[model samples]
Target: MPTPTPSPDELLVFTGSYTPDTGGNGAGLAAVRFAPKTGSLTDEPRVSPVPVSGASFLAAHPSLDVIYSTNESDTGAVSAVVRQDEEVLSPLGAPVSSGGANPCHLTVHPDGHWLLTANYGSDTMPGSVAVHRLDTDGRICELTDVAVHEGTGPVAGRQESSHAHQVLVTPDGRFVLATDLGADAVFTYRLDTGTGRLQRIAVNRTRPGSGPRHLAFAPDGAYAWSADELSSTLTCHRYDPDTGTLAEVSRVPATTVPDVANQPGGIVASPCGRFVWVTNRGADTVAAFRVTGTSLQPIGEVPSGGIWPRGLALVAGHLLVANQHSGTLAVLRVLPTGALSRPAPAAHVPSVVCTLAL
Candidate 1:
């Protein structure tokens, strides 16, 4: 039989893993093509021998020619690679240190001129957020500026310092938002497109003890949603799109606490703008929400049927979940009602897989 070719609109996922060291996570990469029908998948194309040890997170540029990875380690760094022609390519040069430890996530500016990273590390020393400019060749140029987060969250014991977990620029590219798990707040910053600089706007605090992680914006960009990893809840904020101000509107529990505490890592809105999905590490499941304007109501929760749900991506119509502990990837059918079912194209991976694509 001939190898299945991907659809014109089909998205291919690139993920990293840790399979070699039994004591350590595996070191491998994977490529899976998504199918639009019934939201299923065909097969996983093995692409391994990645340079990074623990490739935890990934970001694809808006322009779609380059991709980046966060090599999660105590010695944190970001690598930029291109997908030139039809091949998966390597970084144009060496990786750039994020100026902090365990750089967990990276995001590109909507203008495609700069790249930003969040460092999740220690309490006292905390972590820092750094900015990097991109060259004409789609490579990261220089480390522009770095900001060290100060102060602790409301939690007496846990929030002893700041851990910047995620950084994202608004859809409009006017402001940038960074979430601090230890600080329990989303720090808003103004982006300078030409100079590649970040200026502090305002630090919006979440409910006490709610360790904010990943964030998603509504399709119309009128509302913003944040997932609290420590608290297992989703907070809705009324956003002034022009001014970029966020006012907390409501806070709803995501499947109740103890079962969902380590939840809210990969939070993303479906491309159709009808549903939102968030991955729970503790529950090993993905929570589905119905999106009505800015209001979000929990509709259903589906088991990923794996050890831990780490990363999530929607390609064509299929929902892909990265199973960190089980050393495999799970594909699910996404219903029009925003529910998930039917697992297929499941395969064993090396370590914790973090998938991103063009």
Candidate 2:
């Protein structure tokens, strides 16, 4: 049977942000209704106005109405909320320590039993991935385990220690992958469901000082890509689900804007698998790439419509951008050939870091 189409306002997208307490201008968790047909937002409101300090990133439960977020701060934490439809969200439980400082990303395990986070450690601590168990009622539970990484890259200040920027579960749900920006490597782990623990299985190193930050899998699940934050490049990997390994294959420049220094922010593969879109923070542009099997071809670049395009997500044939510095939400058309339309504000949101489409 064919799946029924979603209505214009049926898609509930939430914005994770940085509040004034974190030196950012966001008030709290906000919600907006996105209209896919016109690539615009219908209305902007504080649907879930809970004050989660530095809620910089968000993820949804795979099979529940719960939402998870990373409180990105010096003393990092994570929280859960029960999303009651589009307008109301109630706290599922109190926020808990993330076992490390400055957690920037998280993902719900495929089995719905675990929530994994990547803690970007502070000056004194090392970055690590923490595992937490969730209750059947979707409540965020206590920390069960943490795997701290060690080693550093060549970059003096930025690479002084391990900083796990993002944690992700493989498409096959067999292995967990983490992009450590300070270590210049992607670490793979296996989660023991019964014990709620993470075991390090593999470490795929990128270019010596690449500073790998985020990982996006190809739609086909045959390849993976990483936004090399420090080196301003994209590294391709051949993903092996059986052995749970990512073998580095190729590299490409992440920025097309001329002369300006660049740091790639968000990187996501299009749902169709033929394209990849990335945001260039310094250049404030979106770079497009055509994926042909194992290699990616540079297509073109488009302005992100606001300053500091920190993150992006592709939904309903559009690229939703959270322009952190400009305090705005921008929408861009994702063309068939892997290009994007001009950046236009769908809403003005302060200190927005990411947009999670539900």
Candidate 3:
């Protein structure tokens, strides 16, 4: 008998979009089937599951059976959807309140016990981080706790109040870190697994106006990098897992274009921990860097192939960028040397803000 060849992995890509709130054209959650080998996506995505407003960020369950998204509306909420098949998703239940206003980012606990959200408050509202208990079926049950952050950064218009942008879990699953764009701080918390509660451990302050937005940790949990939205910089930090503390290592510009208005978006560390990539919205580029033990050496940058690149995902050696303003997803090849090739023509999506691949 002849030997059989294995089929290429079919990448199931999930995207969240900004709806009426952000002047977005999206109707709801969208799904696309991507072929990794060809770097191509289905001509037209099947946008379904739910017609939610402000489904801006998404997080997948560890079991890959459920998906959660932040409903970035005046009354913040998190919605859950069950994965019915390769190309189908259905709402699991009614969205539950995030315990704050304008929830922007979320992540599932590695242990599959909780879902965490960062609520980016408006000018009159205060920012907060909320934890929700997850039932055995991966559906969100109730808001277990909400950790309200206090403080403001130096930027008057943008930092007049706390704006928690993202919530991320440590690789070890013992702690949770939330980045506050308006506060210019990364607040750390100890996760009580048994209770699904968040206990404030430490607050790591960044440069006065850095406006830390999103973070990515090294594979081994030794180091971490934060993408500062207001400052348009990437700050490296030495991560102490046991103590849940982050010490600044270095801060560098995320874009090579000098004096250009830049807003850094997503930050992702390569699986092997050799490289870190950050998206520059104003410059419409993806900046690549070589990671060397808490130090970042700029490698180069490649065009995002669209406008306002807000999200990035590394899947099967390819870098996928979600350009929110242009409403397209750009696929770029990631070379072994940590450089990126020119991105493929944009794939259509309406106000795409985040990407998740499985």
CA-only RMSD, every prediction: 3.5, 2.2, 3.3
Which of the two, 1 or 3, has more lDDT? 3
Candidate order, TM-score descending: 2, 3, 1
Residue 10 accuracy (lDDT) in model 1 = 68
TM-score of each: 0.90, 0.96, 0.95
Model 3 per-residue lDDT at 52? 71
TM for candidate 2 is 0.96
* Candidate 1: pairs in clash: 17-26, 18-25, 18-26, 18-27, 18-350, 18-351, 19-26, 19-27
Please give the distance, in angstroms, between residue 286's alpha carbon in candidate 1 and its true position after superposition.
Answer: 1.2
lDDT of each: 0.74, 0.87, 0.87
Steric collisions counted per model: 8, 0, 0
Q: Show the lowest summed lDDT stretch of 10 residues, model 3.
A: 1-10
List candidate 3 stretches off by more than 4 Å: 1-9, 46-49
Q: What is the lDDT of residue 207 in candidate 1?
A: 80
Name the regions of candidate 1 deviating beyond 4 angstroms: 1-10, 18-24, 38-49, 154-157, 256-262
Candidate 2 residues 6-66, lDDT tens each? 3644566788889999989896677777878777774446374778889889998878888
For model 2, where is the 10-residue window of minimal lDDT? 1-10
